[model samples]
Target: MKTIKNLFTALLLVLFLSAIIIACKKATDDPQPTPTPVTSITSIDPSTAPVGSTIAITGTNFNTNPASNTITIGGVTATIVSATATRLVVVVPTGAANGPVSVTAGGQTAQSAASFTVAIPSVKPVKEVRGTTFANQNWKKDTVYLIRGMVYIPADYTLTIDPGTVIKGAGPELDPTGQNISGTLVIERRGKIIAKGTAAQPIVFTSAKAVGQRAAGDWGGLVLIGKAAINRPASTSFAGGVRGVVETYSEFDDNSGTLQYVRIEFGGTSQPNAPTNKLNGLTLYGVGYNTTIDHVQVSYSSNDAFGWFGGTVNAKNLVAYRGFDDDWSSDWGYVGKVQFGVALRDPAVGNPAGSNGIESQNFDPGENADGPLAKQNGLPQTAPIFANISNFAFSSTPTVGLYQAGIFLSRNTAISLYNSLFYGYPEGLHLDGTATGTLANITSGALDLKGIVLANTLTPVVGTGVITNDLATAYFAGAGRTNLIVQTSDLASLLFNGANFTLTAPNFLPQAGSPLLTGAATGGKVADSFFTSVSYRGAFGTDNWISSWTNFNPQSTDYDR
Candidate 1:
């Protein structure tokens, strides 16, 4: 019996050993579960969805979380709702045009076979907006609007316009006396306009008339009211507002708003109530130092392109293209800094009264010698500072009614201009005023000119009713002004695609070895905390900032398209 038990045990051991061998063979042959095949999309339910609607997208191998997946429709990023391996939900965005929906997940992408049909919202029309109040509302990018009548934005409101918005002003119906009325945009005191446009997508404010019929003064233009120090707190002209009296706050840093990369075209419409003209392309009324205005272009304005009425706001990269009247004008207590400015006078049209490149004043509208409208404290005067300015008046003979020069400084205006180029004018600089005007200011070191170039001017410098022409010319020809060149040539090679006053793609940058390419005065004289330090003069460097951005043909381009 013992021999029989041993034989049975040995048989059991053999069977166990054979089972182990079979298990080891199977373990060695086992395969890994295939990695979740790269995330992919199969289809999107409800292939069409309107803006702000939710969409359900079904896909395969998508990540379990929304952060791992991204979806876009019509190039507009959609707000993610939920994401799973087999499905994703998203909300369509505004300003999304009709286009295919695309899904990307974990290094894998998939697109819908057909485009998602997106219905565009009907365009809204704005007319005769005399009163409208806002509380931090955003004007979207997708809306193109037409404004009619006098649109006013009152105090304590914020109007944040998106990039690439095109706002058109339709001319008003004919009033009595056979004059075509104008539609105006007025930003009243304490109203803020936050229009920060991009270089690629600039905000355009223009006339709504057809291209061929469009002319200057189709609209009343932009009006801004801020609270800053002003010598004359109120304006004599009622159309723009009471000038010499402070309309807004008195804080120097009171933030009015931001205006960047904005183009105001075919503006300067006259108000029915005011003097001959009140608001120009852009009128800053008592704007404070905290207001920001840069990269602004005023094209084909009937009156002044940029006018400052008693404010301390600063500006940079200003372009006045083919304007009929003065390019830059200052009145009241406008204590501002302007850097990198360019003015091109219209060869065809010119204001008979004056079509100066720059005209400055201090309250005394009547060009007399009474001196500045003296303030109670005599504080915060009309002393505007300028640098890197280029004024090009292309016409040899004045236009039909033009009586203008490169610059006219009068009426107790205290100003300083440095590193500038003035050409194509009958007279370069004309300084005049009452007893406390330019003569007194210059003696007091409040009004001065340095590092200037005057070319093709019949008279380089003239002191009106004060110093003689020779004395004025000698004053500008003093030390540190050796690079100032005065010649008759238009300096054709220095500018690209520019001729006359209405040419396109104007490049103001000088060519290699040109005198304007170097020798700009630095330090506290021309230097200020408000401006970027640039060694070159004339509103440009080797790199052209206005090349890809500016629009020379606003009359032809349709804003809605």
Candidate 2:
């Protein structure tokens, strides 16, 4: 009986050992649960540090690998000096503003409970700038540059301006020779200006007067001259050069550098010793195709907002607001391509010489005694392609009589316009100077206008000197043309927010169901690769390109601060 009990106990022990082994195997094969990592920001050392200062950030569950951790303060990326699982050391970025500090790691981001303050440094002393630049120079954003007189960037020199820089032009003053000392920036031939600013930080060139004291003609404007071809007489007022003199061998693709996201306000003063010679807000004199100019705004100018003398440069997203004279003027063999342009006029102000949205000409004197051949067929003629332009004259006010045509093409120029809108003008389109063969350009397909909409104009088409108004009207209403004519009463249905014409704020975007939203012409000059293809007829379909960087009420903004 003792032997039988001992055998049963041994069998029971073996069974128990087998059960334990099977349980151990099951446990080894099964997966384990991973704990979720917790990330939090405790604090940042030197919470108020200026740009480029080093700061230590304390956090939990940060990536041990420095490269794996991404740190941003005030929405600007910072350079990480070192990183640990629980802390990080970083240097503040140059453009960093006041905002919360955040650390992103291990696919998770942690934000601080409080915002980090960026210390404001003392006001940088204003630096006086005058004369010509002999060497490459950099204008820092922190310092305010005061242009006291005409400043020139000579050949082989470059002027680099940091983003968000403020350049103030002194008010017109008298020089020793009893001449007006205007503050103007002239970029001579072969010179460069790298004044590239961002959408968030646009460079501003404004008047030096106090906020309420600013007005048009407060200072001179910006001028750029390159070694591009120009078709002008030797006695040209702005820059003297004979036609075809440089057209065969000039640098059509010269690199005069960039000017992006820039604003020039309260400019356009008369040049010294020449009362008839007024400076435009921005003038391009023989600039070339390699020059970059885009996202530029010229406001409250006494003369034309933008004037292209001769160049092959292309531009986009240009704004001209409340200019006393023409918004855009092209002459002297300007063959550039421009897209997405906006022009808003103020009814309260007008130039006695006549104000128009666009004034294009091949030369000043169309019927020069020099004969018709030199005036009519100037080599490298003033033919520029402009697309998606929105011109608003606001002529419904009492000052409607002061405004002229929306577009005036004369002096035998072959400027082509496509997919554009012109509203509230006395005359929508004017073809002037029959002696100079201006009307012939339209018949010959040299100056083309397609996919155009004219609204609230007393005269939709006008022809002067020999081209009859009926002839001009027939061309606009020709077959295969998508031109539209809308009356003042029907403007509300054609535009989504057309009522807002206040100088403080204006809405240029087309509304849903508006004709400008679709049916843009794609053939002809618009088909060129220089223009961006869109189904919109105007400068804007739904997007507002003028937002954020543009300031419509510059007179109220205090630049001294």
Candidate 3:
């Protein structure tokens, strides 16, 4: 009986304990203590941003503790304005580049749930056109300019002309006796002049008259002054032949000027009686070696095209055409190198009835004892005349296309003509100076008749040298025409197949079978990628900026581009 009573009592106690244990478990499982609910991430404005633009942010989620939780924009903290659970505003840092924004609460970081992007602006085209004037008397810089009767560049001022800029001259036609805008340009005081131009848009210094109506000797030509080594005869005086009486100055490496792709037309002779009044395209009085000249064309000048008084500046890609007197005339102390020159005669025009392709020398041999044509002023003693004259065809008429040049190296001017084609002239190449001469100078010796072709159309002139048998045979072949025919497909392959020629303008392309398409020899220091084809020559190759020969006329009003 005692054992039963004890068991019952133990059961009751066990039941009570079980109930208590169940209640305790239920209380523990009720609900996780509500978190303090720290308001951190507020609100972000302008989810997107532009490069260099400001961004705004607002929110109270930023920590309110000392030093506050970091609210960064593009990794940089923003200027925290009002801070609250629902309001936190900050101006976007200016230097904050483009990226994401982060907000940190306590130690936890809330990744930029909102993303932003940078924007780009658009491009516009040129619409304004204005002319420059020299009316203001502001001569702080050592420069010169001219718009009308006003002179911006004084005789001693250095001038800088940007490429593709057109400068027009006004006033009388060559007669400088009357007060007009025809005064000579004197680059005294070692002043520098920079005229930079490109192949497509050459810097043109021309007269105000229309191109067709414009006459030679219209405006004064470019003049450069410098001090450097020059090539002159032992007996000749420095300033004997030139017509102008320019002031004297000396400067070596006159970091003054640069000229490229410049075209000066309808200049040369002026004041028929006054020789000093004539205009030469580019006249260098005492230019130094620091100046540069390339891809320059002086056409339809009344007198000589180019004349160097004294200097050592190299020139290349020079074309002189339709001049009344000599094409490339150099004399007084000129000691520079000229390469890739093309002196073409206008079959329609003639100079004093008869003249040759090129007329140059260390002295003005034809005019006086120091003239380029004089025997004493011939090559070997004069400055070294290194030129690459090729693919030239003179006029067929004796008055125009006589056996003059093809190649004329008179007065022993140390010159070398290689891989050149001369046609129509009675003489192929003339070496008449009292100096040593050689046939090896003609580059046709090494290659079979494939490179240079000289066709003598007129009766052979006695003084000019004879063409080599190989060159004559190779050029004439069977028809006697030395013209090289380039196919259209071949030109396209070279220009368009690769990145050789980029067609920036609308209609620039070489005509099929054009002579200008022949390629220059490989070894020469000619421009490698000037033309698209391996056979194209001259300034332009093939693109899409020019019209067909039949459709395009020089008299047309439409511009090329």
Candidate 4:
């Protein structure tokens, strides 16, 4: 019996050993699981970087060995500085252009979802511009021009500025004659400035200070002098001219070349010779109708954004932003036609001499009185026509200070405004001075305001001096006049993005159901061929024209490379 038990035990041990051998053979014959190669580029830091710059690329399943990982930027092989399972630091290769970045690792290749832009090496050379130009000069876009002191384009000379050109004006400097020689550009009489730019690339004139250190009045502004009729005496010199004549003969259609899609920022410094005579952002002295002025933006001006001193230059699509003085000021004789203009004021900035959206005067207080009633009935009157204007004095309620009327007419001015929107001003319209002949002009249809909408104004109309407030009110609310007055609450329904008064970003476009979209009066002065016939009351209808090119936050723009 003991021998039989021993045999059973041996059989059991043999069966167990046979079972172990069979399992081992099956495991050896069957296929084993292999790790899945997961090599994928997740992201690239600084999608745009210059050559020789180090960039970190994040990915998945990358080789930990730096040499084992291969990276190419814009088809050029990059040197890997460090590597890990999920990240790789690589130096941008030479000859790398703007293209996709690829990585080859773990026997797999992966490309970035977005193209990597290899920034071109910036070698912005600075050119100091001073004195006058004797011959025709061309300013290229690749160089930065530092306007030091007063720079002038003499008579018969032409200054052509390429598109995307950057011209910076230096800070206030003292001349040998003790005059403040701020950086300024002056086009003499018969001289021309062909600075035409496209919507995608506008010519920029900004302060020379570094970013975030710029402010208004950092430099002088643009001055264009021409020969046109004026209300002042023929022999009276204006500005810095020895005589009033810019040309031998007065030509109404004298050409001053073109100024399109141009931006003037941080300009309008006060003149040292005349402290009260501050330089305007764009000063037109006797300019004529042949000058092409369109899509011009003036921002952060210490004086008037646009000042016309005896000029007949027609303009369109003008923008005046955050100006301390009058947004549009006209004196002497300005018989120009202006259309599609906007003035957006900043509540924090204002002129102590009083700020107005439109300030029109036939002549200064003590000038242009050559004969009897000459100040009131000059040879060439200030009878400019402005249409489709949107003048917002302030985005919101402003502190009571120097804010004045939306339209201020005095000194026998005969300016006309039509199809316009004026809001957020202390007074909507004011006719100052009794003997200014403004009341008579309005009665005779010389000084007219039609199809106007006034909102959020403390005083709708005011008449001082000879004109009576009751008469002004009667004229504004009289028959055949399509003027309407609304409150700030009602303005919300009239504007699509009305509350877009953010300092850095603003939206002046009308909403879908806005009243400004239709009911525009295209008759009278607006029917002229110079004005575009649009069925909109304000500067904008459906599209925001100032969106693409204009810079609202110019203080932060880095001009230097």
- Which candidate achieves the best TM-score against the true structure? 4
lDDT of each: 0.75, 0.83, 0.48, 0.83
The best candidate in terms of lDDT: 4
State candidate 1's TM-score. 0.73
- The ten-residue window of minimal lDDT in model 3 covers 549-558
Question: Candidate 1's error at 30, in angstroms?
Answer: 67
| Cα-based TM-score, every candidate | 0.73, 0.76, 0.51, 0.79
- lDDT by residue (272-374, candidate 1, tens digit) is 6554756789988778888899999999888889999777899999999978889999987788899999887656678867688889877555644455565
Which of 2 and 3 is the better model by TM-score? Answer: 2
Q: Over 4 Å off in model 3, which ranges?
A: 1-156, 171-183, 199-201, 231-256, 366-380, 384-403, 435-452, 459-561
Model 4 gets an lDDT of 0.83
Per-residue alpha-carbon lDDT of model 4 for 325-359, expressed as tens digits? 99999887788889999888887789776799999
Model 3 alpha-carbon miss at residue 68, Å: 80
Q: What are the root-mean-square deviations of the candidates from the true structure over C-alphas?
A: 11.4, 9.7, 17.6, 8.8
lDDT for model 1 comes to 0.75
Model 4 worst lDDT run, 10 consecutive residues: 240-249
TM-score of 2: 0.76
Off by over 4 Å in 1: 1-128, 174-181, 233-249, 376-380, 395-403, 481-485, 489-502
Better of 1 and 4 by lDDT: 4
What is the TM-score of candidate 4? 0.79
